[model samples]
Target: MHAHIALDGPAGTLRVTGAGLPAVELVRAPGTPADAHTPIGTRRAALLTLTVDGAPAVIRPARGRLLRRSYRVDVRVGGHRYRLVPCSYGESRLSRDGRRIGTLESSGDGRVSDAWDAGPTPLDLAVGTALAAAFGTGAAPWWETVGDIVGELVAP
Candidate 1:
């Protein structure tokens, strides 16, 4: 099952509420073809591999999601209502343009949840967070004080 949640912070605000699991896999977006022996489709993927090589990780989970070391949250964000969703303690990796998004993780499941106290954030922020989680700075040294993403996800 899918859900709706939001992440609102001083940096920005965003919402991730959608139903149904994305066809993409937890390891990487599905059908992305990441055999270094072969060619992958995106340069961002290569950069992510280079930038996030061997970074430390600290991940927790929202709701009942797994909250353990070496584990991150797997969140799919979107929806017209309640615009933000955070996985409690995973990291985000945005795309080059800062639009497309996806996430890399050590471990965690659908533990993402909305911050009921603060309420939800704007839809744009939700998208941005998802973007960050997917392929933006969260994937780079700028933010990888946290996780390891073996593959790449794209911008929306």
Candidate 2:
């Protein structure tokens, strides 16, 4: 179970590792139509558990090394050819009128890479030319293109 999350810091501690690292384990998609643990496509990558005002977010680590800006693809796993650490698929938020509208992240291994959902249409310039044409990676945002660094804060 172990899904808490409450780190505000005073005693100082915070390591809610990427995408809600609650013991790390959740992989579906034998057919995956959802319900296998929620969160699917449309920026899929689940694990969740981050409250804050209601408490929950208290893990640790990341007092130093936690760079994590790396990007890669090509995944198979189990059957071999594994490289699947696939993540960044973070989509959830939109307020508008209250002001916020926008969010959408989608690195692969979640399988849907028609060249990473094919590009261009203001999704931060097709997620910055689809993360440099699907993972040669690096370099975007010169004057805004590469869809604003893959749409900056991760598209929407």
Candidate 3:
């Protein structure tokens, strides 16, 4: 079986709705101060927090190298860690333990589709969808942009 959910509205006031689940509205939390010593291009340089349902969840750039053109972010909720990686054409891959469990597509009306057996719970789906919407495709981190600029400058 497959489950589908729709995400609507902007980042601060996004709404998530789907079958068999209550509609949830995610509110973007205020920006947290970044560590003064953490340099740009590091994971701690950029962070986002959202109020999922009623609980607060922090979203941070995941460590490690970038996946081609995609950027990754990590979030923990209900003691479960989830990663959201934005793919080409406005689709974000939602995974846990390196296994893809769901996908969030941002084309037209935003939607999240997942395999029922391997996918996250409805609450998780909502959280993942919200995170994907907040950090959609084509939004590269500052570090990646800096690297691109340096690469172009060095190329023959």
Candidate 4:
């Protein structure tokens, strides 16, 4: 998949397009936190609406509280759930039930590179590409880390 994100407007939007998979656009919610600064470095997150071929699929967090060395996010499309976690060198691995399916890489620009070793469901590609867009946004505010810790403490 090839992805592009628009960050200059009032809302951050990510669009992904590729062969076989329907085009997807993830629009970040107005109040969703998009970046955070941790003790290690910077991280990013977003609550986004996933749209495939102009049809809405789901609204979910594309990335979660992360440390400098590692990142993880839970994503669900249709009834299938997956996790996108940091692997190495700005790359993220997409897995389902502990089995690897695809890998995503961001160019640090607005572009993203993605590949799947096997056939992937559309929702899978949509969520994975959206998460990659969130990662491309860089970091959140340093104070956001405080909220992250507090959120983690209260979350069950």
Most accurate candidate by lDDT: 4
CA lDDT of 130 in candidate 3? 60
Query: Model 1: per-residue lDDT, tens digit, 57-150?
Result: 1211222212222122223333221111233344433222233233322111223322222223343334333433332221124234333332
**What is the model-wide C-alpha lDDT for candidate 3?**
0.53
How displaced is residue 147 in candidate 4, in Å?
Answer: 22
Per candidate, the number of residue pairs that clash is 33, 13, 0, 2
Q: Residue-wise lDDT of candidate 2 within 43-82, one digit each (tens)?
A: 1223222222233332111111122222222222122221
* Residue 120 accuracy (lDDT) in model 4: 72
lDDT tens per residue, model 3, 58-140: 66765434452336777766566778776544466777656677776644244444332364677666766665554453344
Ranking by lDDT: 4, 3, 1, 2
Query: What are the per-residue Cα lDDT tens digits for candidate 4 across 44-122?
Result: 3334566667876644333344542235666555566677766664677878766889988764455557889797776
TM-scores of all models? 0.22, 0.17, 0.54, 0.58
- Candidate 3's error at 54, in angstroms? 0.8
> Which regions of candidate 2 fall more than 4 Å away from where they truly are?
1-65, 70-102, 110-123, 132-156
The better candidate by TM-score, 3 or 4, is 4
